[model samples]
Every structure is written in structure tokens, then in C-alpha cells.
Target: MGVYGRRRCFAVLGLATALAVGALSPAAASTGAGHGAVPAGLLERATVVDLQTAMHARLLTSEQVTRGYLDRIERLNPRLNAVVRVNPDAIAMARRSDAHRRARGARGPLEGIPVLLKENMNTADRQGTTAGATALLGAQPAEDAFLVSRLRAAGAVILGKANQSEWSNFRGSDLVDGWSAVGGQTHNPYVLDRSASGSSSGSAASAAAGLAAVAIGTDTDGSVVYPASATSTVGIRPTLGLVSRTGIVPITSRHDTPGPLARTVTDAALTLWAIQGADPADPDTAAAAGTLPSDPRTVLRRDALRGKRIGLWREGHVGVDADVDRVFDAAVRRLRDLGATVVEGADVPDLGEVTTEHMLPAVLTEFKHDLNAYLGATPGRHPRNLRELIDFYDRHPDGHDHLLFDMADKTDGDLSAPAYRAHREAATGAARRAIDDPLVRHRLDAIVTPTSLPAPVIGRERDSAPFAKTTTHAAAAGYPHITVPAGYAANGLPLGLSFIGTRSSDAHLIGYAYAFEQATNARQTPRYLPTTR
Candidate 1:
């Protein structure tokens, strides 16, 4: 099995019923919530823009919103298993934010906002950076990940750590999507017994459940976008070099990136702008020196999709379920209504070769090399390398899966290995061409497809649904890909529409997604349903 099969990206078959429009309205626009009168369900549907506006107008305070999120997490996290640790200093940070705002105006886009970090990110704080592995239970890093530092500098509160798949879902051959030894399974908030579709599982679920203003997730392949699709949130896998990866638990340095998940595209874009830039530590970020915009939010107009050409990518394992196809078809029609030209048959070439021959080998080989480097640099009495980590799991094997770790241990962690270099070059070249060629030939601004099938039942046998082929090509090419809430399945599970672009087109893709989101309003707040029936 390749990355898709190992990660369990398949969804269960269900009835095909499309929802019309799904923006959640405030229960009460004037309700007292410890601060001034605040809108009820503020945490559930409030955007960062909304929160900031409310705070600036003195209708809400930073402390009130922070406490509100804390209360929600306290109530909902037990059932969802999305959070692994709560920052003991989160409320203090929020009060400090209030003080700062009281002295000077708000700091930036994320000022006074609470954000969750995936457990794989090293935060140099009270929480453990375990990557959901108990082997590194007490291990800590010397400093926050580069992006986390940027977030703090922007005056955002470090809310807590969200659980993720152990070792970012590269630990075993038969790994469940959201299962981790340290944090247990993450239940999809839309349907509690369904898969959250991780490595970035908890981040998506928390964003969907309004556990924080937004959450950061690390994507190697489908980790960020896949989970966001399953949870009816927006996820952006930026150009790999756009975000610094220093201090993150690695699957492959070439493909690893931290991205934001939120209930709206504008919020995700704002969070991405705050956390993105060049880093002295991760030299790969140097490639992004001039690629990013002054602000991604400048392109947030509702008519930003007007006159743009979009390629419809429905080839090779993309159209999986009848319901998902119906949802995607409606999304394409909406795009046309919004004045985008949708060109059909924009398939990536040789997808099979990219998945099997190139992507798998490079992922396996680089995981060993990159993870060993990260482990060596991290502080504490834990596994020093992949080999040691495999032994650690061998000693404590309950709920831990390390078959992939064993595979990595057998390989010499040498980047210059003859086959390794060849595979990496071949994979990068082919995947890049797969995305770039389609865009150039179609004269397209972006490629559109169904992000994934709707959320599948947890631990259920894989059905015959064709695998959704959305994230891998963008991941391998180190390009930008964003997934937005397109619609829902009959079971109330969310479906996503993806927009993929060539290298460093993050701003344009975000603009396109934002427009679609505004036109469709397709993301409803989760119902926490026990089952579809």
C-alpha cells in the first residue's frame, strides 16, 4: 500500500443529499458572556475578523474570548479527544494581551487570539512535544518552532497542543488515521465515531468544534488538508518553503510544513500570513524570500474569482462516491456562476508512477534521515535516533505501531545513497510537472477537485470507494494547495473542494478559496452526532 492506503483515506458509502447553504447564524447577537454583551455561539462561528472587530469595539475582551474557548474545550474535548494538553499559562497570556491592547492598539492579525499547535510542533513550554508518541513523553525542546515564535510575536495566545497521529502517521503500515499512543483516538466532531483523517487530526477537529480561534497542523502528504476536509474546515498546505519547519517532528524535511486550519478561509489566510516568512534556521525558507505578499488578506474580495480560469481535475481516482461527486458538481456550477471558466479533463500525468515508484521511496528514505537529525537536536532523555526509537517501541509496544520505524531503521540515513538521490529528483520533477503542466496548458489560475470522500466510520473496513487524489501531487511538488468546505454528505459529514496552484501561488489560491466559501457558505457547525442513522 502507498501513502493513501496506509493513512486510511477511504470513506464509507452513504446517501447522496446536498445541503443548500450552510453558514451558521448567531443564536443571539446580544447575550452577556462575562464581558460586555457578546453574541451567543460566538466561539462556534465567529471569524478572527469578527472577534477582532468585537474586541476593538469593546463588545468583547480578550480574556472573555479566551475563557470562552477554554470552557468549550473543557466541555467538548472529553468527547472528541482533540486536545492533548492545555497551556496552564493560556489565561495569563490572554490577560497580558488585554493589557497590551489597553496600552497600545492591537498588535497584528492574531493579537489576543488563541491558536492550537499540533503536538508534533516543538513549543519549549509546559506541554510535551511528543508527536503523539509516549516514547518522547517527557522530552522538551530548547525553543519554540520558528512559526510558533512568529505567532507569539504577533500577540497570539498559545492555547494548547492538539493531538496528532503518532510520528505524523508514518509510524506503521496499518496505522489508524487519528490514533496515537499519547493522546488516544480523535473523533470527528460531525460524527463522533468517524475518522478525523489525520496526522493533523486533532487540529481539524478542534477548529471544527471551535476549541480555538484556529489551529496549526503539519502536513507531510495528506495530513492537514485531509483532516480539514473530513471536518468541514479550511486547510492550507502552503508552498513547502513558505513556512519554517525547524523544531518540528519530521516525516520528510522536503515535504513537511505547518499550516492553519479554521472555520473560514479568511481566518486561515490571516493565520498563514502571521506565521509565514523566511527563517534563518530552516534554509528551505530562503526560497520564499520574495514569493509571499504584503498581506494575504488584501485579496479577500468576494468577487476575486471573476475572470479566473479554473481547471476541473476529475481524473484518476478522484470521483469516488456519488454524494461527493454531486457536491463537487454543484461546487463547479457555483464557480461558473461566480464567473470562473471551468476547463474539464485537467488530470495530472502518471499519477500511479508518482504515488508508487517516486513518492513512497523518497518518503521512506527521507523520514529516516530527517527524523534522526531532528531527534539529535532535540533535548531530553528519549530516543536519540530512529533505531533507538524502534527499540523504545519494542520495549513498550502497547498501542504503539512502528512498522514504518522498523523500515526506516534498516536504511542507512544517508541522503547521498544512489537510489535516494535519484528517487528524490525524479519525484520532485514529475510531481512539479504534473501540476505546472496542467496550469500552463489550460491557462489556469488553479486546479479544482474534491479534497476527499466524506468522513468514514472509525475502524471500519475500507469500502471500495476510489481514493481521492488531491494532496499528494501538491505535497510532492512543494506547491500550494487549499481545501475549503464545499458541502456535506447525507450523513452530515462534510466534503471539501480543493484548489491547487504552482509554487508560491499561495495568495491567489487563498483568494479563490475565499470567494468560493463566500458564495457557497457551505460549512455548518458540527452537530456532534453519534452516528448518521
Candidate 2:
């Protein structure tokens, strides 16, 4: 027996003993081994390209790669709680990939690669699209999400779903970012006790920990970028409509888009290439038909930063921790060294005011309307509307259903309210103006900022400081945002630098991110430390 056998035995025995003595807390029980270590070479920090090369060289079969990742998840997921479910048919899927390679060669760049989807994405398979809610645990969509279908066509194995914040954190404002009734809480891989910022918490954590080659996540606001920053991974929130949102459990149609989170910018770009296209099911995607480049990978270049004008946007935001600030400064210096013309103190005036005053109301209204539409279409004996969902929680046998937060407020709203219409109109104009004006007036290719403050400690304080100020402008404007690992803080937690560009500028943004990622090479494989000291 190797590491896998030994670790499995230890976990099973440890969990059994803990339960026998009535000493296991819910968190401890969910995290079985108490340590998030994985054996070296099992699935440690390997990129999708690396895996593809190995598979094509006949050194490893897709089945072997798939098994290795499954083994890694089994050993480490109990502690990280990143992946809630493992596909029972993953090995079978891999076998099919191997067969295809043998009979017809690789189907696409992603052929045979194992990937995890955020739980909100519908798979139309054994896995459920619950969005981490117990109420929808048995519900399944009649078809795969458009993005999921794209991944399948590119020969990706649907390994399973990563856990997400319940209802993509729309359940209530008071709930912790990663806590879900069905999947427990996702822990940051670098420090188990810190928050894995959601609602794409598991996707970021799993990608960081090498649980999969790549993972897909949904970003309505900072969900994708925030968690990626926290976990030291690359997350690309593509331009709105760049990737179809059809079949996803919605928070808001206005901002919702499925994006790729990966260990490297190239990997993320490849995933984006696979998923970006027109989908008749999502009318928004019609705008993206000719907007995307022929190939995103073609834009990846070491010289991508040369002669580019990048603006450092820092105005109208509370500052980051001193360590994070240092990291951001260093990143700026590196960009300048790479021949980029950096503009200082690039301000998006009234960004925060506009987003706060206009964006929130629009999101609230759209969340109620879009979610009701999705729930009505999903199959199963589940709540068909927001009102019924709130009632379900109220009557839950688990008296602790509302212990963290209540969803009663979301149940009372409808989209036709005049106040909501006004907010939507104002938000649309303000967001577009705030984002577009800066790029146009400054003649800048992209804007850069620290993605977030360091991840906060996970607990019941219910009033954690906001950490995503840098992300809100781009999120509200439906622009492309790419977050690359910047550096670790003094306490060893990760931080990220974000690259934001105008709408439909995904390829250019990716080029800048790829250049910065190549130059800094800041990301480090997580050590799974118990805590930051």
C-alpha cells in the first residue's frame, strides 16, 4: 500500500473513533482527517496542458489520471470540504475517453480531463443541481447546462459538483460565505480556519488544491474572483454573455455567467474557449457570437505586457491590509518592469455610490424573478417559488434552519414594482458609464487592483468586513475580470491582483493576466496549514 491506502485507513479509523467517543463537532466530522495533506505527484499543481501532454505520450491513461484525482479528493476533501460529491461513473467516463483516444485520437484540447462544476450548474446526470440546498437535493434538470454540454463535447469528464453557498448566497445577507446545508462549509486550502469566500468557494478551493485539472464556477458578483483570490488560483469572470447561463440555478440573469477557475491563466483561457459561444436558450449570448476571438490560447504571450497601457485603480475604496498593500505595490512594479505603461491613481468616480445605490436593488428584483423561473422548470417535489422555499425553511425539522439567517425577505418581492424598474434603469446606465468612461477617457487597455483583502477568519461574528471593493465595478458593469495570484500575506494567506477590461475584451484581459502570471509566478501550492499564525 502507498499513501492512499495508509491515509484512507487513518481517516476511516479516526472518524470512527471520533464518532464513538461523541467528540466530533460538525466541522470536525465533515473534515475527517484534520489535515489536508495529499501525497506528492498524485495530483499536485498539475496544469491541464501538462496532463494532456502526458496522456498523449502514452505515459498515463485518462483512467489513471481520473483515479489519481479521486484518490486525492478522498484523502483531502474531508479536511477541505471542497468537493461535496464524487461522480460514481467518473472512471467509466475516463475509460471512454481512453477508448476514444485509442480509436480516433483526442477529440479536443480538454479531451479526457476531469473537471468539477459548481453545484448550481445542472448536469442532467446522477448529480443533483441543488445549489447546496437540502430542499432541492433530489431535483435534476432535464438537460445539461449549455456550458456543461460544451465541456462534454470537448471530452471533459464531469467528475461531480463542487459545493456552493446555499442558493449562491442569496438565502440571506447574514449567512457565512461557504456554509451550505447539504455540503457543510468549504475551508480554504491554505488555512483551514479561514473563509473560502463564496459562492464559488468549493470551485476555487478544489482547483487550488489540485482536486481537479480545472473547475467551472458561476459569478454573479465577486463570487468567482473573491474565492480565487482567497485560495491562490486564477479565476476569469468573462464578459456577460461570453458564456451561457442557461440551466444554471440563477441569482440574477443580469450578472450571472459561468466562468472558469484554474491553476494557470492558460488553463482558464482554454476552458473559456471551450465554453464561450452562442446559445439559443440564453438570448444574451446572441451578442457574443462574433465578439470572441477565434482562439483564446493564441493571445497567451510572454510579451503580452509590452507597450500596453494599464491603469492602477485605487480610488474610493478602503485600503487593504499592509501586507496585501505591499504585494499589490510589488505587482505594480513588476508590471512596469515588463514594459507596461502604468497609470497611477486611476479613479472610477462614484463607482461605489452607483453600485450601492442602484446595483443592489436591481439584483434583488432580478434574483426573485429569475430564481422563480428556474425553480418552476426544475424537476422534483421541491419548492416552486421563493415564497414556498422560505416556508420550507420555516417548517424544517431541523430547528436550526434559520440559525444563521432567514430568507423570509426575499420571498415577498416581484419584478414588476415601479421602484425595481427605476433601480434597474439607473443601475444599467450608471454601471456602464462608470466602467466605460475610465477606459475611454484614460485610453487604457485595462485597469488593475487588488482583488480583495485577505480571507477573513471563519466564525459566527456575522459582521465580517467587506473584502471585494475592487471587484464590484467590473461585476456591475458586466465587464471581464481576471484575478491572478499576487502573493501571500505575512500570515501565509493568499491575495490576488485583478485585471478588469471593457466589455467583450476578454481575450485582451486574459493576455494581460497571462503576462502578469508568467512574470510574477506568485502562486504557490497550498501547504494545508492548520491555521495562519
Candidate 3:
């Protein structure tokens, strides 16, 4: 039998063993203890604009900013397990940034900012690009991801790599969203027993807990937006190809894109602008050339939504949680009060059948093809292909490093298969039509929905009933999706209001999201409570 059959057998046997020993405790499995007291006012919720002003006024050095964040990470990360590794060179890098500002003034928009990267983004630094996998622990790429280089050139200090869902949550069906064997489980900052969501778990949690000024994450589907919603942060999944994917770990080249998660829409917009550009290494980025605005911040007006037609997508006939629905309705009312014309039940063609039949199969084929290409290019002694990765797991069946899910199923079929090709084409076509037809029909500027239900309890394998289905539509259409904090649930959990626009409509989407954010001003910093009572 191949790895799937072996995995089934091992799981059956291991279930008993795991139960006997009891599944790993979140606290006991953590790497270190929480340390340091919380920082003083404004620092916790300070935006990029605030930090820039402080630096320009000589009120704070980059080193001091970096050290403060490092202290926050040291204090909070152990409990949240958000950051995977702290960069040894971070202080030194900040010192260099300080020197540059003193000698030549601010280099660019992101000058002297501290940003954390999702672990999957390759950085040719002291930190490793592990993707939260022990097997690839020491695998460092020869250069930084195109986006990371852009951040460096803009004078942002690279704080370090944040934890991620192992292999971007493609390893198995039973895999927990935010739990990676390499990093344990990342807990929500608001409530320690709740999940932060993943595979962008660390990036979102870090931003929410004030461990970093901003964080970068990659989204295949809901990885970035869902986690941002869970943590009450702003996440922007820009139009695919708007940001280069080269030098980052791959899941599917077609659906994969880097995004920004920050405490405010302005900060997220600034980070998006800094990283977006055409790169020859990734030919898809050619489409984004001249399409994006010169500065997305220019569109951050409180009046941006005035006279715009916004679609309120109520999941059609599907039911959502009563509390979540109540919050979403309030958000729509707020939009109307802000001068946006809200269109209820906008007639978007449903792509549910297409997603059920085609999306997963296409993802499976793309994962095998694209990941092998990425692995082949990397310099490492680790598994070079999906098959080798499965074999590595097989060798450690009973060890702490054993795989939680079988990847062999994803590698089962060849990309050349006619079934796979047909599904891929059908899914892409359906997704585009589903989103585009609605906008054209309704004359809508954007579509709005809840980014997700309140985050689920931690350690649960999946989210409970009433999950949001909107992310698939945007992800498959390769459109821009922005999520801003809407309100808190009765349980004190946060919910997000998503603004999704057609492909290459990132500037408009950001404008709308920023406008709503300015109007609502709903996001609240986490209290880091032990748990929800």
C-alpha cells in the first residue's frame, strides 16, 4: 500500500496511543514561558502612520521600536505561540535603519517599521524558512522573497519568521488549523483557549497582540482573511499576481498570493503598496503593472464610500449564526448611514457546485506540481518531493514528528490527467463568472459579508457549523478580499466585515474598506484573557 493506506493504519493505532498519553496540552507543549509586562499606551494599537511620525520627530529610534516589539513578542508569544523564531540580527538591522534615517532621512514609506513574515516566505537571513515543519528546520533560501527584498529596500526592519500551519495546512484532512508540530499550537490572543486560525495564524495573532507593527501572510483561500477576522485585525488578500510569489513556499501558483495583516486598514494598505510590483521571475505579475495606484493611502478618505453601491451578501438562503448575523446586519446599516447605497440580496450566480466538484481537485493537482518545483529549487537535505515527504513521515510514525495527515492523496494524480485539466478550467471560469456577473448586473462597487464566524474553540479539528463560504468565491476568482473588524460577539470574540471586489480592483476595495473602518472604528486590542467565561 502507498502512504494513504499506511496513514490510515497508523492513525487507527496511534489514536489509542495518543488518547492514552492524552493529546498535547497547549501550555505544556509551548516552547517558552510568557515574559515582560505589557507596554504603555498607544504602543499597543499604534499604526504605521503613528510610528512614522514618532520616528520623524526623533521621539523613537528604530532600535527602540524594534526592542519594544521584541519585548512584546517575548512576553506574549509564548502564550500565543505566534512567532516561530526571533531574528538575532533584528536589533542590528534596526540600528542600520536608524543610521540611514539620521544620515539620509526616511528611505521610503515603510522606513524604520518593524514587520514579521509568515514562516513560509524565504529570507536569506539567520532565520530559517521552515513553514513550521521540523523536517525543513534549517533550510534557508539563497535570497529573500521578492516582497521581503522590497520591504528591506523600503527600510522596514525584518523582525523574524512567524509560526504557520505546517505546509500551509495541506498535509492532511484531520489537521488542526493553527497547530503545527514544529511550533505547537498558536492560540488566539483575545481568548487563549480559542484558535487564531491558519495557515496565517501567527501573522494574524502577532499583529493583534502587538507583537509586531504589521505581518505578512500568504493566502490560498482563507488563510489570511479568516485569521485576521479571528484576531480583529485588517487583512488584505490583493488580486492574484498583484504581489510576486517567487522565493516563497508554494501551495498552488494559481491561487497563492502574499497579503498584509495589520491593526488598521491604513497600515495594511501601506504594506500592500510597498510589496506590489511586477517581477520577471513570476510572469503573472506583468498584469499588475500600471494597474495599481501610485499610493493606496491617497484613497483612504472617510468619504470614499459616499454614493457607492455596495452589495450585502447574506449567504443567500444559507443560515449563519444568530449573533454573527446580527453583527453583519449592524455593519450593513453602518454602511448605509455612511452614504453607501446597500443592495440587499445582490443576485450573484452561485458557484457552490463548481467549488464542490472542481476546486479541491484542482488544488490537489496544483499542490503536487507547484510544491515539487519549489522544493526542487531549494538547497536542502530534506524531502524534495511529496513522495519523499510522505516517506519521511512514515519513518517517524510513532515519534513526536510524525505526520498528522497523508499528503500522498494530493500527489495521487498527474497534472496531465484530462479530469484534472477539465476541473481546473471549469473552476476558474465559474469563479470569474460568479463574481463578475453579479457586479455587472447590480452595478455594485463591492460585495460585503462576514469574513468568518467567531473563531472556534482551540484544539478543535475544524470550525463548527455556520462557516462562511464567501472566501472560496474570492480565492477562486483571484480577486481582492479585504477584511476589517466589524464588532465583537456576545462572547467577546471578534467578527470581521469583508469587502471583496473584482480582479485588479484592489485600490477601490481598499478605499471602501478604509472608509468603513474610519466610520466604524470597531477594532479593539485583545486583553489576553486566559479564556472566555
* Candidate number achieving the greatest TM-score relative to the actual structure: 1
After TM-score superposition, what is the CA distance of residue 245 in candidate 3 from its true location, in Å?
A: 0.7
Question: For model 3, what is the C-alpha lDDT against the true structure?
Answer: 0.81
**Quick one: best lDDT, which candidate?**
1
Whole-model lDDT values for every prediction: 0.84, 0.81, 0.81
lDDT of 2 by residue, 1-533 (tens): 11111123323224334344544333322322232222245467567776676556544567766877998898899999999899888888887887888788787778889999999999888887889988897686889999999988988998988988888887654677888888999999999999989999999999999899999999988899999999999999999998999999997888888899999998898889888889999998998776667755468888898999898887543364687779988999999999999987567666556666777767876877887899899988898977777788888854444421233244345677888778877887777777778788888999898888788887532455544466666777788899999999898999999898888888888999999999989999898888876
Task: Name the lDDT value of residue 9 in candidate 1.
Answer: 13
TM-score of 2: 0.89
Q: Under the 3 Å rule for N, CA and C atoms, how many clashes does model 1 have?
A: 0
- Model 2 residue runs over 4 Å out of place are 1-39, 316-319, 350-353, 397-419, 460-468
Model 1 Cα displacement at 272 (Å)? 0.2
Error of 1 at 469 (Å): 2.3
lDDT of 3 by residue, 385-452 (tens): 77777787787652433232343344454778888889889998898888888788889999888878
